[model samples]
Target: MNQSATRLNTEELNLALNLLRAGELVGIPTETVYGLAADASQPEAVAKIFAAKGRPADHPVIVHIAGVEQLAAWAQNIPDEAYLLAQHFWPGPLTLILERQAHVSDAVTGGQNTVGLRAPAHPITQQLLQHFGGGLAAPSANQFGHVSPTTAAHVRGEFSEEVLQLVLDGGACDVGVESTIVSLVGDKPKLLRPGGVSREAIEAVLGDSLEHHTNQYTAKQRVSGLLDSHYAPRTTLITGQAARLQECIAEKLAQNQKVVLICQEINTKLDIEQFLMPSSPQAYAQQIYATLRQLDLQRFDTLFLALPPNTTEWLAIHDRLARAAHHRY
Candidate 1:
């Protein structure tokens, strides 16, 4: 592992801060995934993130802060639910969408009245935010619509040093997926995106059922990771149940196409290359992106991932896989 991979080095932290102050992009680690970060107050700095990733100007990014105390600087008319969710899930993988304050840049909110905010639990990034004392508008540290980076090495591979100079290596992400996004701007809190935080858990805290609004393209307010074909890999990805995926694998192999499979079980021996994934949802989320990146690098004709159980616990995983897949078998 690199010296800064899992630990915060003072020199590296300072360099990242300096880069952000100078309106440059920095790859900052978060508990969810690595993020391409810039000072949120600087629209020009934030624009570089979109330019480098080829992200759409209309698609909004999340602004990361140190803790709940800084929330008021970016959002106005904050609801009690926002505070409640932040109290319970801040410094973790929950992103709250609220109405933007007047000073909040349109670049951060994608020309909308709403802005997404998260307080990441990564230690190195926490330190960076604390020292910088400002919000960093960051999206996943990878090309737009690609699998997000879960490690510093992955971030480095995504962009040239000129584009993204310093990647503060905080090692592999704990919650390999992005943050759970809940839009509090509406009369009812809507679950905009299923992610690291479970919907059930968030509902339990709110004491009301959340309105399911994942993948709502018609929504006037945009949030991160809500697109139809996001988090995809370069290689063609086909996902389905184990039996169905196996059938597809055989069909592809028969056509003389190279195929790989990642699943929870193996009932029979087949000629296809295979990798076993964790059966548990938490473990699965942590490894899914890295596994996809690994398989994507092998140049396979197709990548087959057996779908896990369709349950509340696996909702986030299913949502991500659905968007990542090129086709469903």
Candidate 2:
């Protein structure tokens, strides 16, 4: 990693702000993931994000704001539920979908009537937003449909300095996945994506269970990270239960194929390559992407992860892993 690309000094922050103000992209850190950020008010600047990432134009990017007070600047017809959730989860990882204000650009909303907004908790990003005093249309700072970057170095590795000149180093992301997306557009709030914020926690705040609408064909909206095969690595990835994965390892080794395993327990008898992931959900989320990036660099023929339990606590992890894997049992 280049030493210049990972600094969080006043000079770097001011440079980032200047770059963004000038309609250029800057990699900004959030608790969830590093974002390729552009000033939301600048449609041309926002379009640069899509061009750089090769992201589909229709796939909307979340507009990150400084705080709840700025909500009306991007969205309108706000519901009480939006405030309730934002009050609890703002400065954290929760994105609320609401009717877009007429002035909110289609570039940011993906030509939809609604826009996604969040107030990220990373202090450095918060400071930047405060100084800039505007929304930043930022998606994960990696290639489209690839594993999201979780650190400043990861962002640097994704795009060249010429493409993304400044990356504010806020260290490793605490919540390693994207923000939880809840849509308040229709009659009922829907859980578009489960992520850094758990669905249960969101439901508790609204006192109503959110409708699970992720990856549904009939769905009317397109949001980030919902594509069937996203967050994938260049190397093939397979995911299954412990026994099935162990069987896969055996089958692969039998054919003289090189493989690696990411699991909670290391079966030393197998004798290939293995990484022991954290047993807890939060810890696992924080490390999964960085782990995948690390292993993907080694050129393994295949990578296998022992799927965590299919339970509410692990829903976010399961969602990401499911999308990342080429094959799932």
Candidate 3:
């Protein structure tokens, strides 16, 4: 049985901040997704985040601040490139990995010498940070390795009230995905994750080409949401071009296998389990996770998704599905 978490108002938001001050976790809304947040200063509070989400100790979480004013305290040797990117994209969906400050915790950085930081673009979250006056180490508010929740209801569906003390309902996330993470700890910036901030947008500001990380995880590459088999549903998912996916579905039908088709363009007349998605990439990104969650609740044994176009606009969407299907880069 799932216990519904409370939706916070102004009064309740203050109460939620108090809970964080007491070293408790709260599900706070960001433009990306709901995040399980705790005071970044407290190692114990950060540890609870890993405990609640069942997140691996080796994988790092992002530290969210109110602004760049807190950068020197959280990160060291801040690069000129970091400042340029932050000026262009902070208070939006972008994460920067930089050389860890002397005081930053190993628990937050996954025992590494670097940390991920972002100033969220949500009003409630910004207000909370303002009142709290510190950083919050947060990851997506759901079981680790599962599809990320886009709304307060999605969070309630995932965990009971006891597990998540309070939820600040800022409604559904506008971006509906995680932030784009760039690692400035290297000689040049490398794209760790493709997300709301397009690579093209970042490169245009830098006046230099950016290196795209393949996400081949080593022990040292302890980045958030970079595991090979991540963002998966319970059922197997195979994704490719529309024609190829259709042929595969036909082959499965011949074997009398239980399958469901998820696509934007497909044969609607066919008598089979299907979920139609929006053709636009941004709209599709907004609903993709919710679609997978709802479809996974049904009796289908396999989920077949027709691939989106291979373009920069579709990069974030493709990155997500490829990981969901456990496709290596």
Candidate 4:
């Protein structure tokens, strides 16, 4: 994997702080996913993040802070709901969207009026943010619209050494998906994206149901993972209706295609390898990305997946797979 030798000690943190302070991007680990972080205050450095990831300029990035106190500095009209949720979920996988502060650069918000902010739970990243004492605009440390990295080695595999010089090695991510994004820009709070935090949990805290983004950006754009087509791999992916999975596999085999089944249903009559995943929400969320990346590494010709039950817990997994199977969408 050619993992960077840079440790997460005082020396490494000092080096990362200097690189970021000088307007350069460094790979930082969070419980959700590894992020390519740059100084949010430096527009040029933030722009470099877009260039490196080949991310669209209009797609917003999350500004990670050291703690809850920095929230007001970047977002405006702070709502009690944000604090309530952050109090319970900060230092975990939750991102709140609020009206962008006037001084905050539109570049960080992808020219949108709102910004996403979070206080990640990883100690290494928390330490880095504390020492830096500034907001860092970071997204998944990988190519735009690709499978996100869950480990330090995965980040190294995503970019060349010259491109990502120092990846803060913090082992595998605990929550393998992005943060749950709840936007408080309008009259009500909306769920732009779901991650480690389940909607039921968030709603329980807010005492109100959240709105859903319909992806109707006909006139304007604002989101991180709402693209109709994203998080795809070079290998083809086929999402089949749960009941009709066998039919889908049969059709694929009939066509002489190599099939890799990534679901619970196992039909021994079928002559293909199957990888079973945990039905439990927490376990599935932690392993989904690493599973996809492993399949991509195996150079599989096709992946046949059955949909998990359409429950609140499986929301984020469904969203990611739907994007991975962008062709069907």
Give the better candidate number (2 or 3) by lDDT. 2
> Which pairs in model 3 have colliding backbones?
none
Candidate 4, residues 203-269, lDDT tens digits: the string is 9998899877736373144778888887777688888675576776778788987779787657577
Tens digits of per-residue lDDT for model 2, 1-329: 11223335787778888899999999988989999999999999999999999999888999999999999988889999999998998988999999999999999988989999999988888888989899999999999989999998899999988888887888898889899988999999999899989998998989998889768464577888788999999899999997878788888888888899899998777787889999899999999999999999998999999898788989999999999999997
Candidate 2, which segments miss by more than 4 Å at Cα? 1-8
Segments in model 4 whose C-alpha atoms lie over 4 Å from true places? 1-7, 214-221, 327-329
Q: Name the candidate, 2 or 4, with the larger lDDT value.
A: 2
TM-score, every prediction? 0.97, 0.96, 0.93, 0.94
What's the true lDDT of residue 114 in model 3?
92
Candidate 2: which pairs clash? none
> What ranges in model 1 sit over 4 Å off?
1-7
Error of 2 at 213 (Å): 1.6
lDDT of 2: 0.90
Model 4 TM-score is: 0.94
Q: Tell me how far candidate 4 lies from the true structure as C-alpha RMSD in angstroms.
A: 2.9
Q: Return the number of clashes found in candidate 3.
A: 0
- What are the lDDT scores of the predictions, listed in order? 0.90, 0.90, 0.84, 0.84
Query: What digit string (tens of lDDT, one per residue) describes model 1 on residues 1-329?
Result: 22245546778877888899999999988888899999999999999999999999989999999999999998999999999999999989999999999999989989999899999988888888999999999899999999999998999999999898888878888889999999998789999898999999999999999888766565556788888899999999999888777677777888999888888876467767788989899999999999999999998989888898999999999999999999997
The alpha-carbon deviation from the true structure for residue 293 of candidate 1, after best TM-score superposition, in angstroms, is 0.4
